[model samples]
Target: GQQVMQIPQYQHVQEGEDFTTYCNSSTTLSNIQWYKQRPGGHPVFLIQLVKSGEVKKQKRLTFQFGEAKKNSSLHITATQTTDVGTYFCAGPPDSGYSTLTFGKGTMLLVSP
Candidate 1:
């Protein structure tokens, strides 16, 4: 069995500050998924990274996959109240599967 390790467990940033969260897995992955869960809301799909060194961005948020496909990261620029939530990075626990094993999410707290 493999596990995904997410760092920090929690992050607090002031408005307009930057924040980053890292994810590492015990095994290589074919793809990874990012999700954002706002307070009192369910997780919402953000994006999927598949390439060895993939990078994607949505507005002020940037996502990256390590060249080895065993790690990933999410960076948010200029945090805001709208960005307050828990961000999760997940990957398939093994090959030939679509079900994902999620990290223990990095909770983001933005103070205005």
Candidate 2:
């Protein structure tokens, strides 16, 4: 069985501040995905990484995958009220199945 864990279950920041979250897997992953869920909304896929040491960015958000493919990170720059939400990292284990295991998620709160 594979397990994904995220740190700092919650984060609070004032407008214009930055935030970051980390994820670790119990087993190596073939690929990893990131998602965001706004208040009362379903999770929305943000990005996916398949290669080792991959990095991607969307506007003020940045994502990174470890070279070992067992860890990941997400960073947001200049937080805004609109950015409040929960971020989740998921991935499939070395197993051959397509099912993915998701981390607990990091909840972000932004204040003006």
Candidate 3:
């Protein structure tokens, strides 16, 4: 079975600071997806990476995939109170159905 894991389970930052989270997979991934869940809200898809050493950015956020395709990272600049949420990374395993396995998630809290 394939597994996705995230580091720094929790983070607290002052408003206008920065934040980051890392994700790793137990097995090679065909693709990886990122999501953000607001406080008490459902997970919202952010982006997906398929190629090795790929990088993508959305406004103040940046995402990267390792050249080995076994790890990934998300970085946020100038964090704001609106950025408080849990970030997750998910990917399909090498076996069986197409269901995705999600990482434990990194929780971010921004204080004004």
For TM-score, the strongest prediction is 2
- Judged by whole-model lDDT over C-alpha atoms, candidate 3 comes out at 0.93
Clashes of 3: 0
| Best lDDT among the predictions, by candidate number | 2
How do all the candidates rank in terms of lDDT, highest first? Answer: 2, 3, 1
Clashing pairs in 3: none
| Candidate 3 local lDDT, 16-105, one digit each (tens) | 998999999998888889999998899999999989999999999999999988999999999989899999999886454578999999
What are the clashing pairs of model 1? Answer: none
Locate the minimum summed-lDDT window of 10 residues in model 3: 91-100
Q: Tens digits of per-residue lDDT for model 2 on 1-112? A: 6889999899999999999999999999989999999999999999999999999999999999999999999999999999999999999986777899999999999999
**Cα RMSD for candidates in order:** 1.0, 0.7, 1.2
- What's the TM-score of each model vs. the native? 0.96, 0.97, 0.95
Judge candidate 3 at residue 17 and give its lDDT. 93
Q: Pick out the ten consecutive residues of candidate 1 with the lowest summed lDDT.
A: 92-101
Candidate 1 per-residue lDDT, tens place, 1-112, comes to 8799999899888999999999999988889999999889999999999998999999999999999999999999998899999999999854778778899999999999
Ranking by TM-score: 2, 1, 3
Q: Which candidate, 1 or 2, has the higher lDDT? A: 2
- Clashes (N, CA, C under 3 Å) per candidate: 0, 0, 0
